[model samples]
Target: MSTRPLRVVVVGGGIGGLCLAQGLHAAGIDVAVFERDTAPDARLQGYRLNIEPVGSRALHDCLPAHLWHILVATAGDPGPGMGVFTERIRLLMREDAPPAGRDPSEQTHAVSRVTLRRLLLAGLDDVVHFGEEFTGYRQNADGTVTALFADGTSATGDLLVGADGANSRVRRQLLPHARRSPVPGVGIGGKLRLGDGAAWLPEELVSTKNMFLPKHDFLFTAVFRRRETNAATVERVGDQLRAAGLDPDLLVQDAKDDDYVMWAYVAHRRALPADLPADLPDVPAGGRGRRLRELVAARLTDWHPGLRELIARTPADTIERFDFATAERVKPWPTTNVTVLGDAIHSMPPVGGLGGNAALYDADALRRALIAVGRGEHDLLPAVAAYERAMLNNGFAAVRAATMYLRLATLPSRTVRTVARTFFRLCGVLPPLRRAIFSD
Candidate 1:
């Protein structure tokens, strides 16, 4: 170790980046985050997040205790169970949350994406820099790295991290061969405000997330009920954070205006129209949303009327359309003082709740490796290499798993679809199989 303490520069202040900052700050390490967004709520896509065991562990390990309390306090009610249903709302199989495990980290948290972003940004006022565009990075003769910005400014540190999202500029400089390929599917998601709720909705729809299998696609829906409204939850949590002398105003916007029923419709590429504008990459989300809504609304006529109404009822602006893309596995590269994490390194199709969770895992894993270096257990460069190796293994595995789940959901094979339906039918009967496959 040198006489100077280790310092890290993180680009993109997303969940993964902030989580790493939190962990390093807690461990008494020097770190700074450069973010392009003007503020925490600059991009408020009020989508709900199902933080599984892995993600739960990451947040718990990274966030300060008081903020963690806020996390628990604000988390929506867990789905607790999942029910696989046919296109017409007939239950085929069900899987409950895993039986209590020895690992206390085996808990689940359902919160809004916006809410979690705010939760992660707590107490990092001095550490996080906003509106800083990271153009690229450079290595010095002394082995330190410097990140350049759009304003002709730069920040140098012992190590630089690219926690930026899918279109990471860092990855481009490091591994030009690595590419993010669009997964062969299209999806649209929305949150439906449940004012007094829909009368035709069944108890199963409210109690658990339901996967509806149409002829050649999947419709996943879940009910979200935060203990309080988004404003109230933030106000209550904000009060506690202020009392603790923290950044009370960090969480600016409501996670959602009210409790809602969330839904996502995914279609197999094989079923897509040859001239489908749905796959056009340049269209804005609102336009793509209108196109996707027409397509989904047509396909979902065979599903429950209540579900149809819910999708139709989703406000136009709140409708979101995104193409699934997975980043190519990062091949073995020479280790330096620079590295990448999260969607910056491994972008996955949206499935299995793995994308964000896997990124959180990356932050924690990298934090642990740095912790080892801080303790003099490993040399800095070698420690970063070892962490990269493990990160690639775990992160790409998550990408593959998420991709496989997406394929299974949207596979157009008649025989495969039959097998899938039959398998779900069996899961309805076989207790051990149900426990094995859907352990979550």
Candidate 2:
């Protein structure tokens, strides 16, 4: 181990980047985070995330106990389990069904991405630099690394980590050949306030659930049932945030909402025939909350009435369309002072809902490796190499698995859909088989 303290420059202030920073900071390692977003609310923080055991464990290991408490406090209402259904509300696999590898102690929950990010940002007052977009990096002859930002400023550190999302600049510079291609689908998603209307949705559907319609489209819904947010709860969260030195007001806005439901409609890119009305409006780039509801509603004409009504009644401003991308395969690179994690190294479709979870796993694994190096337990280069090896093996496998699952789910063949549905149903019955099929 080097005599000097290990200095790590993380090129992204996302979940993975922040998690690594927290762990390294806790371990007494010097780390800095650079984020392009000017402020915590620079953009609309996305919807809910299904945090699996791997991700939850990472948080448990990386986050300070208080922050972890906040995370659990803000978590959505607990569901019995995830359910799969058809467009007509035909139950294919119920959440009440026994899971394959049931671990009652290892419970997974849905959390708002925005809330999770805020919790991760806690106690990093001086470590994170906002508006510092990473442009690239250069390995110094002295075995150090210099990360350049768009503002012409740069930070030099013993090691560099590209936890930036899929379009990571560091990954681009290191492996220019690695590029993300479009998957054969598109998605329309939005959030709705589920106040009294919560009674209108099916109890199972309003809970954590996925609806796989036979029409090559899918709907995923997660309801954030109202939680007790009286003065005491607010004071507790406020006190925790202040104790962690985070801005208490950062969470005030979110606490105002009692309940919400996030929903998405995903389908093959070519679901709409070319012969359809050419005058259909295109979703605006920056608009949100229902801009594309009509276009999506038009495509879902043949879907179940309930599903179609959900789209049609959606507040026009909440809906947005996302063009899906094909799975990415990262090419190997020589290990050096620079490295990457999360989507920077392996970005895939959301088919398996493991993208965020995998990112957390990457953060935890990389943090462990780097902490070992900081403690002189391992060499820096070898530590990074080992981290990359494990990351690629797991990350690439996730990408491939998500790709395969997406292909099968969205393929316009009745035979393939039947087989896929049957396989999922079977996995529920066979715990060993479920363990094999479900990666995250």
Candidate 3:
């Protein structure tokens, strides 16, 4: 290895990438993050979040104590367990929020994705290079790696981490055989302002992670109420960053209008908006909200009246669209200076609340492993090999579980539905069963 201090080049500044950068700095290692977004507030992000345990723990591990507190301080209390319902709002069962098996101080039950990212970017203004799109990377002769960029600028480091989201260019270049196949259908989703849907929505829908399993499709809905408004969060987090020797004004986050209900409707490609192409890569710009709402309104004609209205009344611009895809068990490969993490290597649908959490888990796990190398406790290559084994095993397992959970809603078997309904009903009265099922 070169005599230079260890450095990590993280491509993509999403949850995983930024968190890893924070952890690396906390560990006294040198790191840099590159993101394509022109600035932090350039892209609008979904407001709701359902952070799982593995993810929450990772956030605690990777972020500093004050930063972690910023996440908790601005979030609402964790509500009761999520509820399951029939198409007409029939209560099937409710699975209470899992018990905090670990110390409560280490847990972050819930926080908006937007705010979580803002906190992740703390104290990294100088480390994270925005608007610099990553193209590819080449392994250096001295065992370092050099990351190429769209603008022809380059960043070389002892290691390269691909934390880019679902369509990671790093993964494409590093593992050519590892490809993401689209799920059979697409996900049509949007947000309904609290004022618009709360009055008509059932308490079960308002309070829990709501689910609707119709004859052949699924509808997932949940409320996202910010304890502090976006404006307040921005100012508070900005001050917190300033106190931590970071400049927040350089890439301040934009405030949102209001808290709302987030919902996703999963169906075949036929449910795609009439005006949009089926093979479109992502949610198109400008007319997306109106187009997705049209598709959802048509599909929910037979749903509950409240749900129908919720779908019908959701603002066009607030509506979101996405295609479905899942990452399978990543085939094993030789360890190198370059590796992958988060959605770049393993991604699943929004169901089961695993995607973001899994990414956080990857950040913490890799952070600790690399920290060991920085501390001279192990060699870089060996440390990475161990990290990849744990990461791939857990990451792929989470993907499989998330995809399976989503598939449960799409299964056409009447028998399967009946069994699931029975299980939910059974959990209602059985304390032991409730503990077993919701303890994750």
lDDT of the candidates, in the order given: 0.81, 0.75, 0.78
Better of 1 and 2 by TM-score: 1
Question: For candidate 1, lDDT tens digit of each residue in 362-440?
Answer: 9999999988888777889999999899899999999988888788777888788778888998998998998887786
Per-residue alpha-carbon lDDT of candidate 3 for residues 1-440, written as tens digits (9 for 90 to 100): 33357899999998889889999998889999999999987645665577766777888788899888677756654456777788888877777654556564444365766667777887888899999999899998988899999999999999999999989999999898887777765677777778643687767656767778776678888777756655676677767767765554432333473567778887655535445534255755437677667777877778789888878877777666766888766787999999999999998877868888888888998999888888777889988999999889988988888787767766667788778778877887787988776676
Instruction: List runs of model 3 lying over 4 Å from the truth.
Output: 1-4, 98-108, 228-257, 270-288
Residue 170 displacement in candidate 3 (angstroms): 1.3
Better of 1 and 2 by lDDT: 1
TM-score list, all predictions: 0.91, 0.89, 0.88
- Which lDDT tens digits does candidate 2 get at residues 174-283? 88888898888666777777767646665655766565556566777766653445344567687887887766555645653446667877777687544322223683
Instruction: Select the stronger candidate by TM-score from 2 and 3.
Output: 2
- Residue 416, model 3: Cα distance from true site in angstroms: 3.0
Q: What order do you get sorting by lDDT, best first?
A: 1, 3, 2
Span of 10 residues, lowest total lDDT, candidate 2: 272-281
TM-score for candidate 3: 0.88
Candidate 3 Cα lDDT to native: 0.78
